[model samples]
Target: MNMMSMSKLSLLSVLLIAHCSTAASDLPKDVFILAGQSNMAGRGGVSSGKWSGDVPPECKPDPSILRLNAKLSWEVAHEPLHSDIDVGKTCGVGPGMAFANEVRLRANESKIGVVGLVPCAVGGTKISDWEKGTRLYSELLRRAHVSVSGGGVIRAILWYQGESDTVKKEDAQAYQGKMKKFIMDLRSDLNNPSLLFVQVAIASGEGRFVDSVRKAQLGINLPFVKCVDAKGLRLKDDHLHLTTMSEVHLGIKLAHAFLTTLK
Candidate 1:
């Protein structure tokens, strides 16, 4: 072979090797996207060993889903409390742990190992704040893409927002349209038309808009989307957040929804 031909061949061989290596890397067999407002962000106190048996060695808890050199690490999701904010004395755990545990349990027969959870929940965020094509949504999509690129296959999205939108009656009707658009955009961005969405209905409360938002969330009839009711679950004194026990209960409830999808 001539020098130029030999060089071209070598380059092609290098490219093929790189591609094979990436393909061979152990990507997450399952990936879960956890997103929403304050409740999803979690307000309950942190408990040690809450996820003792189920946590995969590779999975660690980090608030912010920070990516470095195409790899992800965890960081605290909240800091520099705003002036108007009230930091609940107790930190409430949300559904992420329970969901992971459920996956481990259900996958016991198959023994699927190391489920990756990408939690990007922010407190006090409105449904409108999750708008597609916006900076916030763009960041979310970017993180998701990176996670997938890093060998994580996104299997589902867990949403727990709507209180803010529900409080404003005028915005309730438009929620359905907004939610539909968000789902479509999410699927398109992720290139996964069948992405599973497990939504948590706003728990029963004093607010008038809660029921409206729940109804709207349930109204979206897209395939692979299901809503889990949190009405009966006991919430915190603020009448918004879930207590530790309630959080665990909520998590189990979410796990049930996820299992249903698997079936």
Candidate 2:
């Protein structure tokens, strides 16, 4: 090769290395996906088409914690984590921020890496909506991919859903199979057979089939899947969604599960 061409190749390699280093510094090393329905999107302090704008100390944002925005860009995460993603609902305090904060604190204590949360939950979505070919599922995978494109390692998926599926007995009865398939498909598509899952068992539901759905959620005996029961958490005035404090509590529980079980 000519001397000029060799010089150009060396310069290109140098610039590429610099760019990659910058990107690595910008992204977090540890990542988590938060996916589910309204409770996962968060209904805490949300009423009459508005959010109360209340944020608990445990759910506070930190410099070490980042969220993948709707634009697939990283930003400092805060409460109402799904405002842009869960557009249809009045987003409020959810377990996400609390989960991230708790995880960050615990990770920091252990000298672990930073935390990145991918919020992809849509309010009131059914399990059927997250089937492999569906829009919700596609979006979830898209966001997850974008999250890890910057070199972030996806540690686990934090799921809290199934309220929508409780409206009918058929949906409730089919919940187990659908949920297992959902987990399997996500793992397969993500190319991580051992991807950890921390799922919150439903505290409340739309209809009379809450127990059936909860039973199905707790019955999934996968290798890296762990279920955290939310049955005792406090619900809001609507008698359906969890209260703000309850979301914080759930976040703590999720962090505990992630630390003790999934680690």
**Residue ranges of candidate 2 with Cα displaced over 4 Å:** 1-20, 109-111
Q: Over all chains combined, what TM-score does candidate 1 have?
A: 0.74
TM-score per candidate, chains pooled: 0.74, 0.91
* Residues 1-263, model 2: lDDT tens digits: 99999999999999999998886797978889999999988889888988889899999889889888999888889888999999987899999988877877877454547788899999888999999999999999999989888777889999999999999999999999999999999999999999999998998999999999999999999899999999999998888899999999999899888888533
Model 2 TM-score is 0.91
Write candidate 1's Cα lDDT for 1-263 as tens digits.
89999999999999999997864454455667778766665655433413212322212343222212223542222221110121323234566766666566667653545566666666666778889877658767876876677666787898888877866787776888898888889999888999999988888533578778888887889998999988888776777777656766777788788887655
Pairs that collide, model 2: none
Backbone clashes in model 1, listed as residue pairs? 43-91, 43-92, 44-91, 44-92, 45-91, 45-92
Strongest candidate by TM-score: 2
